[model samples]
Target chain A: MWSATDPRFGFWLPLALLCLATGFWLTDRKDSRKRLASVTLFASLALIVFFGANTRGGDTSETALLAVLLHMLGPVALMAIGSLIATFSGPTPVGPLPRGLRPLGFSMAIGGLIWIGLMLIEEPPDAIANGIGETIWGAWVEVFLSILILVATLAGAFCIMMGDERHKEAFTLTILTISAGLMFFEIMHNGSDGLEATGWYQIHWQQMVFLIGGLLGIILAFIAFIALVYMAERRAPDPDVVAPLTEEEKSVVDAVLRLNLELEEVEE
Target chain B: MSEKKDAWWGPIALLMLLIAFSMNLFVWQLSGGVEFSSIIDRMVTGFSLAFGITSFALLFVSLGAVHKHMRWQEQILGLFGCAYLGIKCYGWVGNGFDSISEDAVILLAGLTAMLAAVGLVFGLLLALVTGREHIPDLLLEMDSTDGDVAVELED
Candidate 1:
């Protein structure tokens, strides 16, 4: 019997929901920003639904149904989010994703789901060996954290340099495309580790996941680079036909010219 | 073009790799249950410290360019960044006012300010590195020139 008073279960159910909401909200939408920004507001709304269901239900079955639904929907939602980001990055009407990125995003989402399933199966509450399990899990966390921080810092550098909307969107898409799987793995791994703080999984699984994820990110970027090269070659603009500036730009340039006193204005 | 390419990437990539390696040490140090005394002793001569400082300096440089390009947004954010750092420094470096309520107010304000500083700086830094900031050349014929992407989009 899972007690309502038990801190572990009490803590987890809400946390899972929070992670879901955060994932949903953080997704860089092409049309609009995340509508629900306040955690308290979302938490209150979540509580209303949970309590509403709780009052009208077979408690155990209802809880189990939700758990299953959440786990199943998690990876799918991640894929959808990544695809949305991809649409923003890739050229519209022509292609929704840069050639290699579609497969890469799919792989990440599926790989994350697989890892989560394996981890859940391997980690049970009444585990016989806990120490060895913790050791491996801890190592997995340490390595993952190291890589995550390094990658984020470098990305921060790139984000600082690229101010244009299209380029910013490209970077955002690149991150989501490459990392949707790893981020899923992160969420799952932490959840399992927190559940009992004990999980005897093969350490190779962690290393293999990390390797596959890093390689996929690299491959996606490489493909995008090639796509850019091919795009330039295919759609070469005429050497003589320079684009005319818009009225706004002409005025801005004129303002600069006037400020510099390089060009005197003639009577209209 | 090749020389320019080499100059742009050579030092930056090497520095990033070095920073990445040092960050591993940072994670190791911050993580659970360790011999604190010996680790603190090694902290004096650790490569991680130097690497961390270098990264911070580079981050500042990146943010400074962002600040320059960011225009009015920079001034708005910088005022808040300075305030947060000021309050945090007061707490960290010295004992401030006697009232806990006042301290709490500063803490809350500090947190918000810190978020603004971090989020804005990181986003701006990346923007500046990737995008071209407008620099008008008065002597050049404006009709002939267009804004070029700083790191050419055409590979």
Candidate 2:
């Protein structure tokens, strides 16, 4: 009973085409299959754009699209590009990025962060239906505050433990910790536009639980994997003992060692 | 040396306990100075949802790995597993298919992916900055036993 004319078909069609394209692209190594994948990908994208433009309420679709691109994609893309440049433009360049570009990279990265901060404060897309902008800004604030608290706490603890030499650092960290903690309390009490204080508190606790659970799960999984590997290795029989190296093998080893030692000496 | 290390354990344990107790008290006070039941329920729900999402994502990834092996039976099973998990994710989000708008669902997925990407990028950037980009090589070096290295040198 499903037909192309169905209202939902527009959404489903592009998704199906995308999935098909991905499958072909991943599974096939041949050129023809790659061509087919490219074609399907383009077709899916074209369909998505066409349907997006022709939605029941065209203005809403356009607004949503603008909001997503501006609020979500733009900042992310800027951050990623900026971070990549900055990372590779260091004194020890990771790739082809010139060290001379470090300043530019830093500017871009900071610009991206400022954009995000401005978006949070301004709530430019808050008028969008479903309050997507508010939700995103709330999530960002929670994460930012969490990170600030965590970093400040850890740094404060470390500085305090480092004896008199780091007393100033410890004092600064304590101030930062207190400030972050206060900010967290303030946000939880006052809440944001579409969400109440109680709701914010609920979300904060939920996220804490989620974060703790995730960390524990990852740690446990890693421990389990390591234990399993150890057990499997233990079950394996020991390798047969090998005879001592022959004169030729010894000579070869000595030659390689000598070459390495000579190279080390030269480098020194 | 061992004794010195052991000497720190008592203090560390006491510190941890103190922190935990203080946190518990804080949470109790925050929960309207009421009984702990509501806070516990919230925590339980959060933990369950976290584990559920993690388990489903892991299952999907493992199934994708199976599919890559190109075994028909396993691939078919993986397809079914993926479909079931996809349905479960939808249910978790909206209770049913019709309850959530298509655009909202898409936005949620997109946001999740974007956040994950951001985390990944930052992590990689940290690694680069910390000169840990040769971690793969370090792991390979760790995996090579002394005897194996000797044998390789001889060969």
Candidate 3:
């Protein structure tokens, strides 16, 4: 008897799916830059899936099944799209891979399945009780997913910094902002009794903090990724490495001529 | 070979740790919820006081390092110590001193102290590893080689 016309259920379900789909498409683009959109895209999909599943289906409905299906579709497709972009964009040199990061990614996928399974089995805690009866198992799923996203983002930032030092400052600052957002969210989620008691909870600016910061981070990371691909594609061949000045190099030589003359006079 | 073993701050951190440990113990000792407000106020003050003391010390260390008189190694040591103290203080304060179950506080305090202690131990290990690199030079170098003993800044 769940009405498609019910604003609470009807609105949130497709809105969440739209966010996920948008993330999926951006990550699916041919451009290497779009592939760098991976973390936000992945995180958004996971969150959307979770929110969608919880809302429309009360643990046992066909709606939960459909939400899981969409969840699987978005992330896996994006992952494939990212790999393809990385491969086809030429041999872009990346930084050292973070320890246990790929495994974390795989673990998050497994955790997602477990989360859906849990939702299917038990009803979510009521609004008033809030975190009542959130099992250690459920908490672990959330923690694992958060950590997975963080590590993956760090790995991506590392690759961008190695490929282009100029973008390093911007990329790192973006990373810091995203990390701060996650940290703030965690702190609030852990306990925000003061805010809740003071009645600021209903305003829910916390979600805005997560969304805005995450969007900005996604944009910066995308720019850095594309820059890496550009460097990789335009890199000189091995033969060109030892060869004498090309036209581009000769222009630099002419510019340095005055400086060389000045150095000669100083030596004399 | 210089004896620089004065952990005056250790007692301070330990005091905060004890407060965190004892608050819950004392709360439980008194049987539950006789009067909530006075208990809540005392708990709040105790937690805030711990946080303030530790953070104040950290601020002093940070400020001291801006001047030339403080050695770089001392600054590093101070930072690690400050982090330890800060963790204990924040843990006590943030957990809402007396609101939760005493059993929960016990576990929380134990975890907080264990993590801080581990960090402290790791810092000691780091000191041992890098001590070899600096000790020889430090032993050979006289304090007066720079010829002027500068007083710490008045800030």
lDDT: which candidate is best? Answer: 2
State the DockQ, from 0 to 1, for candidate 2: 0.09
Model 3 lDDT per residue over A125-237, tens place: 33211321122112222222333334334433443433433353334334433543444344334423222311212112221112223233334334433443355445534
Kept native contacts, as fractions per model, are 0.01, 0.05, 0.00
After superposition, candidate 3 runs with Cα above 4 Å error: A1-34, A37-53, A56-268, B1-8, B30-155
TM-score of each: 0.26, 0.51, 0.20
TM-score for candidate 3, residues paired by index: 0.20
Q: A3-81 in candidate 2: lDDT tens per residue?
A: 4333345454565666567655665464355567778889867766666555433234333443454455665666567
Off by over 4 Å in 2: A1-20, A47-69, A93-100, A126-133, A140-186, A192-199, A202-268, B1-69, B85-155
Off by over 4 Å in 1: A1-81, A84-91, A95-142, A159-268, B31-155
Tell me the whole-model lDDT of each prediction, alpha carbons only: 0.38, 0.50, 0.36
Quote the B-chain TM-score, candidate 1: 0.25
lDDT of 3 at B45: 34
Which CAPRI level is candidate 3?
incorrect
